[model samples]
Target: MAGRRRWSTEEILDAAAELLRTSDADSFSVRKLAAALGTDSSSLYRHFRSKTELLRAVADRILLAAMDDYSPEGDWKQRITSLALHVREAFGQQPQLASVWGRHASSGTGSRLVMEEVLQALSASGLPDEDIPARYHRIAVLLAALITSEARVSTVTPEEYEQGMELFRVAVLGADPERFPALSRFAREVRPLGVDRRAAFEEILAAQLAHIEDAVHPD
Candidate 1:
């Protein structure tokens, strides 16, 4: 067997991210993390009091890694949109990490950088200096919520979702056509469980962008 390697914090964080990306939210854990790092679980206890701490550090690094993919090019609006989508995709790429993101304490600088960039993007949009923070917060929350919800929703496998659709059809659409005319009528037009999540996401993103644009450039 190869000798145990002394992993730096960065390397450990990277490993933590790998662990999250490849494992389910329930099974991948700090013990697994330590094993992947070629160290004893007890050794990690010195640096992190709990699993949450170690994972949060890993998540923070993951956030930083995301910035490399965020171009932030184009006009102010386009730049912000690009950045938001990139950030969203970053979290979406790692479902386990997204499941617990921002819930634990963190000392990482990635969140700060993201915040700074968003605010700067707002400033470039010709938003008033005093208004940038609120606008940034609004955009940030929407992007985070969308990505987090995507992660949660994606937890269900395609087969499971189809099962759910069948259940929904029986429970609601099949209950009473007269009592649930609107739903039944809609169900007639649409498949029981064939809602396009990507389409819904695009609509939501467009609405949020329009909402923010109105706030920043109100007539």
Candidate 2:
């Protein structure tokens, strides 16, 4: 007998995470995952059914990890910040999965759990009952967009990152003073995104939460 099999869905996803962490982009496929597992790709098919299912499983794994690390008890700002940061941190570790997951705003297990907690936080923070869904969408979409953008660049090497920043600065400096006066004047201040890009990102996150709060609880 070839034996039952050693790998489960959990094992497959663990290997998937490894591939995602190591590569700039994992061109994911059942066959590749199987090879990585040292088992027949057909075995993966038995559990996952298709590549889409496999991707969703991997995504669930990623989100579940984020949720496990998340602290659910805190002020709305602190709690939301914690949740968003955990998700983004997981993306940083497995950047290639961002696209697979970015568009999926769903009510599945871990995702659903996080969404409910977020809605509760909004309600607790004084968002109107009818307005929470819209606000939640706004927050979720913003996080998805920002994290997707950052994750897409997660594998940029030190040299490429520096060169890209230099090119941006050069372009800014070259903007015509007459036609692009504001940019030309401010170009010197347009420095590269230095270490800790998340400092700026967290500002946006805070602003989003604050915007929601101010709308509901304006002074």
Candidate 3:
């Protein structure tokens, strides 16, 4: 008779991440993950105390994969921008993991490394010592909002997304022109143009970095 299957933490996380990548976040479960690994839920529970813990571990695994030994280059603005873009790319690639990110705060190696890098960048940003924490929090909140907002869009089927966008466009364009003239005009002119999410992300990052620069060299 075969002995019991033994799973390492790294193997468990890898399998969990693959399951998440291919499955809907709302429907993912430890039982499902164990089935995928050809094991029982008891095996997974031995490694992870709960589904929430498992999800957070999977998120950290993705983040570490995204970092991939990357160290940011150039000044503080450049460094933070590089880090943020790496994280955004990871979430964009595996949007189900965004749900994990949105729900849990990672205290694992991956997240700790990321936090350390960001703090170091902020320290080098020329902000007064008293101001680093606030600025760091501001940037963290902004990146989380922007990255997760885009990731949410990525989780849907393309046809579903386009259909939803069309509905939104119609609602905006159909609004009473007299009552919402500005909105009507913008909807007709700009809404139809479509959004380039990468470009938009870069633009927002630039604005945020500029604000940091301003704090350092205020007029």
Number of the top candidate by lDDT? 3
Clashes of each: 0, 0, 0
Candidate 2 accuracy as TM-score: 0.87
lDDT, candidate 2, 1-219, per-residue tens: 677567876788788767766552346677777887778878888787777776766766778889888778788888899898999898777778776677544335877877887888888888779998999989988988888888767768789888988888778988889999999888887766555669978999999988987997789
- Cα misplacement distance, residue 35 of candidate 1 (Å): 4.3
- Candidate 2 worst ten-residue window by lDDT: 19-28
Clash pairs of candidate 1?
none
For each candidate, give its TM-score against the true structure: 0.80, 0.87, 0.91
Q: Give the TM-score of candidate 3.
A: 0.91
Q: After superposition, how far is residue 82 of candidate 1 from its true place, in Å?
A: 0.9
The CA-based lDDT of model 2 is what?
0.79
- Writing each residue's lDDT as its tens digit, candidate 1 over 1-219 gives 986666677677777778777775467677888888779887767777888788778777657878887777887777776776676677767766876664552457887777878787778877679877777777767766776777776767789888887797687667577887877778656653235655666677768667777877789
Error of 1 at 78 (Å): 1.1
RMSD of each: 3.2, 2.4, 2.0
